[model samples]
Target: MGRLAVGGTRDSVGVLCQVLKTGVPSALLTSLSLAQNNLGHLSAMYIGDALAAPALKRLRKLDLHLNRLGDRGVASLAEGISAGGGMPCLDELYLGYNKIGDAGARAVAGCLEGMVVLRELDLASNAIGNEGALAFAMHLSDEGRDEERMSHVRPRLLLETLDLKENRIGDDGACAFRDFLACAGEHESGMGGGRTEEEKIGLYCPKLLNIFLDQNRAIRARGRNALQVLHTTRGIRCMEGADW
Candidate 1:
């Protein structure tokens, strides 16, 4: 199949899951959307398992927004992805309005470690705070202190868009994003030497073109100013609030 968009079909998701479980094959499906389905954590768990299956490994885009998947649900999804070693070609993931908190955000960061080709991730209108934002920054900006560790865990530099609007992020989270930008700049300019051009072209999220941090009422002037510097220097689009 091509694009299986069963969004807003709250009552039929169970049947969809059954079809996903029994039918489909690898590289056949490209996109799947189940947004606004009133899905809970259990449903998210099943979808995550489906993502890991060989049938859905080639899926490029997945939409699960406007649901009730809380922290537990998101964590279960992450665990399913990690365990199954699936969704290797997934590019975009939408999970906005899921009521996810810090723990769920951390699980997502861990899950992102394996999605090497993923380019966009949407977590808007959730409950992510500084802890969760910091986790994302750490994974996005980590350049590996040693070769052994680097060989085992690689940073997710392919991410281009990150949507974290309407969350609980404050100054600390904003500052972490600033640091991520700095790391990306350094990698882009080849300041961190000894790596090949292919590896260094866009390390530390060099391709991150847009970032959304608006409506985070906790972000103060300091954090806003910090990001402002990068916006001017790094030439990346940032939307923090009216202050910016």
Candidate 2:
């Protein structure tokens, strides 16, 4: 549909309460950019709580940039998103210029595990460092394990696209991420239930295509080579820098 940007100090909490209470759905199904709106951590929490309205589920893109949502605020927002649910259809999420450190990134990583359909996520300029990146990588590894266990009895999950730009990830964090991707790719390819080689390869080929890991400064030559190995083995293309 269209987009919705609510600003001005008209008591954001009150507005959110009204929106949730009245259930007035916006008629747009596109993006929701709330950047440069001076939303502090508390305001962001309130706004996130207000977004529980079912109407917000129609949004495909969401931007909450320059809001100064610190670690606590980011955790609150992620919790709110999980509680609100209906984010299965969400494609892109932007949370740049906040103060989300490692704790905040861990919270986001937790939320991401639940969003099986999410494609793109942005966490740039948020004071996220190697610890944050490592936390996220650990989350992916855990997710891969969970997927493996599930595939033994049920259907598998598909998750693609992730962005961690300008987060100052170090070499160790980069290596961890690359390792997780490689292992996940292998597991996904191998979990075809004893299918033919061609069938297994087909199932594995396109799954990694949807993953995007761009803008990790600590990604050195070895890390890049590891990613290349994953690409060659799994036939997945991981984008870097502004390629996304």
Candidate 3:
């Protein structure tokens, strides 16, 4: 399936829903790309409902890029993913484009509250501003600020690659991410029920290695300077604006 492009179609999501209802466990269905489809909010809900099918248990990769699934559709999708036990095994999510703004980003953030399975995520060019970027950063960090307070539970992601190449993550947003990385770098794990130091740095979700922030035009040397904190640790790569 080379770049499964099925845009401008409203019925495909219906067909997908029907297939999902067939009760055939989609253990082999690892990737599905319905990007560029103006699969609007209503159609997106159909997709969301389909995702709730038990047959689609093993489904992982989902690409809704360039679709018109605005905040409402995204929220619907998030709700479906969370209900009835949720797709806990999902690893990669591509929600680039599709006119997702900060509100939608917030919904996505809410969806990831306790999730820690995702490894690669791309929220590129979704009109995400500082608030949205900050939301994503909150989840992406290796660890939270207060892990000692809640040592009994595991939180956050194992994200390795993240892309926020466009939209509006200005200086403030840039600083937020920089500080988050700094905190992760300095984080030390406790020997109690807490996760290992690497996991805590990433909130028990380490292995974040690459980040792309190209063409935002707002991040300059000042923001880049703040990013130096990440360099203090090894195995991390970043590309900001034209410097990449």
Instruction: Kindly list the per-residue Cα lDDT of model 3 for residues 71-114, writing each as its tens digit.
Output: 89888888777766677777778888878888888778756643
Candidates' lDDT values, in order? 0.76, 0.63, 0.68
Q: Sort by lDDT, best first: what order? A: 1, 3, 2
> What TM-score would every model get versus the actual structure?
0.84, 0.74, 0.80
Please estimate how well model 2 matches the true structure, expressed as its whole-model Cα lDDT: 0.63
**TM match of model 3 to true structure:** 0.80
List where candidate 3 sits over 4 angstroms from the true fold. Answer: 1-8, 25-27, 113-115, 142-152, 185-203, 240-244
Model 2, 80-105: lDDT tens digits are 67766546666778888887888899
Residue 139, model 1: Cα distance from true site in angstroms: 0.9
- Could you give candidate 1's per-residue lDDT for residues 1-244 as a string of tens digits? 7788876443466566656766554347788888887788878877776665666767799898988999988987787666666468879999999999999999998777667788999999999999998888767765322355565545455788889999999998888877775545464453345666655545556687767888888989987876786576555566844433
Best by TM-score: 1
lDDT of 3 at 137: 68
Model 3 clashes, total count: 8
TM-score preference between candidates 1 and 3, better one: 1
